[model samples]
Target chain A: MTAFLIENKYTVGIMLGVIFGLASRILMLRTDYRQYPTYPHGRIIHISLGVIAAALGAVAVPALFNKDYTAITFLTLAAQQFRDVRKMERDTLTKIDELELVQRGTTYIEGIAMVFEGRNYLVIMTAFFSSLFAISFTWYYGLAAGIVSMIIVLALRSGKSISHIASAESVPVKQDGPDLLVGDIYIMNVGLKVNQELIAERGLGVIIKPYNPNGKATLSNLGQRQAILYDLSTILGVYRDDGEPALIPMAKLDMRDGRLAIFLLPQEKNASKAREIVLRVPILESAVRMPTEAKVNQQEGS
Target chain B: MGEIKAVVTMHKQQVGGGAPIFVADNVKQMEETAFLLEKLLDAAVHDLKNGTFILVKHK
Candidate 1:
C-alpha cells in the first residue's frame, strides 16, 4: 500500500486535501437557533460549494508542483464564485426578512453573508496547506496540518457575543402616562389604553449597560438593536401577530449614558431566560465599533 | 421616522397635512378610531398627549 501510494502520490495527496477541506466546511456550516440556511436544500447548496472549493484548492497544489503557474489564477476565479455566494445569501435573507415578525436587520444579514464567503476561503486554505504538506512531506503530516488549520480557522470564525461587550440585566417594564419605558429609558408612546395595559401586564424589559465606549457605540447601532429584537422575538416568541404594530419589540437607547433598554412582549414571559438570551445575542461584525481605539480618544482619553 | 398613515384626533383643528386625518367627537371616540386605524393600517399609534393620536406605519 505504501509503495503504491508513492507511485500515485499526487492522487492520494489531492484526495486527502479534498477530504480535509470538505470536513472544515462541514464543521463551519452550523444550523443554530437562527434556523438560517433553511434545512435540506440550504445544506445541499453549501456542501456542493464546499466540494467545489476543496477541489479547487487541492488541484492548485499539484498544479504548482507541475509548474502550471496559470492555474493559480483559478483561485481568483474561485474568489469571484464565492462573492456570488455572498450576494446569493444576502438576497435570499433580505427577501425572507420582509415576512418575518422580527426581521433580521441588514447588518446581521451582511454578517451571515460575510461568514459564508469567508468560510469558503478558509476551506481553500485548509485544502491548499494539506495538499502542499502531503505532496512535499507525507500524508500523516498533511492530516496533522489539516486538523491544526481547522481549529485555527474555526476559532477565527467564532466571534464574540454581546456578553463579551455588555452586561444585560432584567428590568421592569414601566409606563409613565402614555410613554412606555424600560427602566428609566423611555421606549415609545403607547396611545391606546388597552395596549398600554397589555404591555404593563405582560411586557418584559432589559437594560443593557455597555462596559465601555466601544460597546456603547456597537449597542447604539440601529441594525444591532434590530438584531437583538429579532433574536429575542425568535427565541422567546413575540406576543404580537400580524397588524399589531403597537405590541412590537423595541430597543431604545438612553442618550444620556448610551444604555440600551429593550421592551418586549413575549409569549413565554421568562425574564431571567430572556436576559440570558439578550446577553448571548451575536454581536454583528458591521455593528462593532471601536471608538476608544481611535487616535483622538487614545491621545487624551476624551 | 415613519409615514403618518392617518390621524385620530378629538379636535380636527389641531392637525393638517398630506396624510389622511380622522376627527373624533370625544376622547372615547378618538381612542376607538385610533385603535381601529392601527389594526387596519398595521401602524403604531403614538399619543400626542393632547387628545391627538397619530397612526404611523413604521418601516
Candidate 2:
C-alpha cells in the first residue's frame, strides 16, 4: 500500500490540490443579505465555474510534467471567460438596479461586478499554487500551501465600509411646514399634506460626517449617496409600496459642510439598526474620490 | 389620484435652446403651476435644493 502511494504521488497531489482549490472557492462564494448570486440558480452557476477553475489549476502541473505546452493556452482562455463573467454580472445588476426604488448607481454596480470577476482569479491562483506545491513536494505540503492561501483569501474577502471613512449619527427628522429636514439639511418638500403627515410620523434621519477631505468628496458623489440609500432601503425594507415615490429614501449632501443627510421611512422603524446599516455599508470602490491626492490640492498646500 | 394642491417650480439657467415654459412670479404661483403640471402630466416631484424641484414621470 505504501509503495503504491509513492508511485502515484503526482496523481494524489493533483487530487488534493483540486479539493483545496474548490474549498477555497466555496468559502469565498457567499450570497449574503443582498441576495446577490441569487439562490439555487446563482449558487449553481458560480459553483460550476469554480469547478472549472479548480480543474484547470490542478491539471496544469501534471500537464507541465508531461511537457504538454498546450495546457498553458487554457489559462488564457479561462482569463477571457472570467472577463465575460464580469460583464454578465454588470449587465444583470444594472438591469435589476433600474427596478429598484433607490437605484444602485453604475459605479456601485461596476464595483460589485469587478469583485465577482476578481474572486474567480483568486480561486485560480489558490488552486495553481496548491497544485504546484503538491507536485513539487508532497500532498501534505500541498495541503499546507492550500491552507495558507485560503487564509490570504479570507483576509482579503471584503473591502472597507463607510464607518472606516466616516461616522454616522442618528439625527432629528424635522418637518418645517412642507419642507423635510434631516439635522438642518433640507431633504425634500412634501407638498401633499398626507405625505407630510406620513413623514412626520415614521421618517428617520441620519447624518454621515466624513473624517477627512477624501471622505467628504466621496460622500459628495451622487452615486455614493445613492449606494447608501440603496443599501439602507434593502436591509431595513422600504416603507412605501410601488408607485409611492413620495416615501422613497433619499440621501442629500450638505453643500456647505459636506455632511450627508439620509432620510428613510423604514418598515422596521429601528433607529439603531438603521444607523448600524449605514455605518457598515461597504464603500463603493468606483465612488471613492481622493481630492487630497490631486496635483492642484498638493500645489495649494505647498 | 389626489388633487394637485401644492406645486414647485424649477428655473433652468443654462445654455439651451427651447420654447419658454411657464415662469412663476411668486411662491404661490409656483405652487399652483407645479400642482397643475403634476395633475396634467403624471410625474413625481424631486427637490433639487435652492428652490428647484424636478417633476419626473415615475416608471
Candidate 3:
C-alpha cells in the first residue's frame, strides 16, 4: 500500500487539489437574495472555469518536480484569462443594469465582478496549497490543508456592510406642501396631490448616520447611494414602474452633519425589515474612502 | 436626470418654454390637465408653486 501510494503520489495530490478547488468555487457561487450569476447558464460557465483553474493549480507542482521551467508561464496566462472574466462580468452586468427598474449601480456591479475574479484566484491558491501538502507529506495533510484554506477563503469573501460603519434607523417620510422630506432632509418635490398621498401611504424612510469621516465620505458617493437604493428595492420590492418618476426612490445628503436620508416607496412598508435591510447593505469597495487616513486629517482623526 | 417635457399652468403668464405647454382655466382645471399629462406622458409632476405643474420624464 505504501509503495503504491509513493508511486502515484502526484496523481493523488492532483485529484485532491482539483476536488478542493472545485468545492471552494461551488461554495462561493451562491444565488441567494442577490440572485446573481442567474441560475443554470451562469452557474455552468463559472463551474467550467473553476475546473480549468483547479487543473492548472494541481499540475504546477508536478511540472516543477519535472523541472519544466516553462510551466510557470501558464500561471501568468491564467491571470490574464481571469482578468478577461472580470471584464466580461462588468460588461454584461452594465448592459443588464440599464434595463433594470432599480438599477444595480456601477460600483455594485464592479464589486461583484471583482468578487468573481478574486474567487478564481482563491481557488488556485487553495489547490496549490492542498497539492503541495499532499505531495510533500501525505494525502491526509492535503485534506487538512484544503479545509484550512477553505475557511480562510470564506472568511475573506465578505467585506463590511453598512452596519459596520454606520447606524441606520427608520424615519418618517414627511411632506411640507410639495416637498418630500426624509426627516429634515429634503428628498424631492412631489407636485401632484394624488401622488403625494400615495407616497405618504407607501413610503419607507431611513436615516443613516456615519460613525466617522471615512463612513461619511463613503456614504456620500453617488454610486454607493444608488447601491443602497438598489438593494433596498430588490429585497423590499419597489412600488414603481417604468416612466413613473414620482414614485422613484431617492437618497439625499444632510451636508451639515454628514447624515444621509433615504426615501423609498416599497411594496412592503415594514419599517423594521427596511431598517434591517439598510444595515445589511454591502458598502461598495470603490465608495469606501478613508479621508481620515490622509496625512492632513490624521492628526485631527487620532 | 430629469427633463421637463411639458408644463401645465393656471397662469399662462407664469411660464414660457423650450418644452410644450398647456394652459388651464382654474386650479381644478390645472390639476386635471396636469394629471392627464402625467398619465399620458408617464412622467412626474412637479409643482413650481407659482400655479405651474411641470411634467418631467426622468431617464
Q: Predictions ranked by lDDT, top down?
A: 1, 3, 2
User: Per-residue lDDT tens digits of candidate 2, residues B2-59?
Assistant: 3332335445452123323455666667666666665566665544445544455644
- For each candidate, what's the DockQ? 0.86, 0.17, 0.78
Query: Which model scores highest in TM-score?
Result: 3
Instruction: Using DockQ, give the best candidate's number.
Output: 1
Angstrom error of the Cα, residue B23, model 3: value is: 0.6
Question: Over the stretch A1-302, how does candidate 2's per-residue lDDT look in tens digits?
Answer: 75665578788777877788789889988988888889989988988888888888888888888899998898999899999999999999999987877678898889889988888888887888888888788777888899998999999888889999999998879998767899989987766456678888899999999999999988888888888888888898888865665787888989888899999998788888989999998888888889989999999999
- Candidate 2 regions exceeding 4 Å error are A294-302, B1-42, B45-59
iRMSD (1 decimal) for each model = 0.5, 3.6, 1.2
lDDT of model 2 at position A74: 88
C-alpha displacement of B10 in model 2, angstroms? 19
Worst 10 residues of 2 chain B by lDDT: B12-21
- Which lDDT tens digits does candidate 3 get at residues A1-302? 87876778999899999999999999888898878898989999999999989888888888888889899799999999899999999999999999999998899999999989999999999899899899989888999999999999899888899999999989999989999999899999999888889988999899999999899999999999999999999999999997677888999999999999999999989999999999999988889999888998987757
lDDT measured at residue A208 in model 2 versus the true structure, 0 to 100: 94
Docking class of 1: high
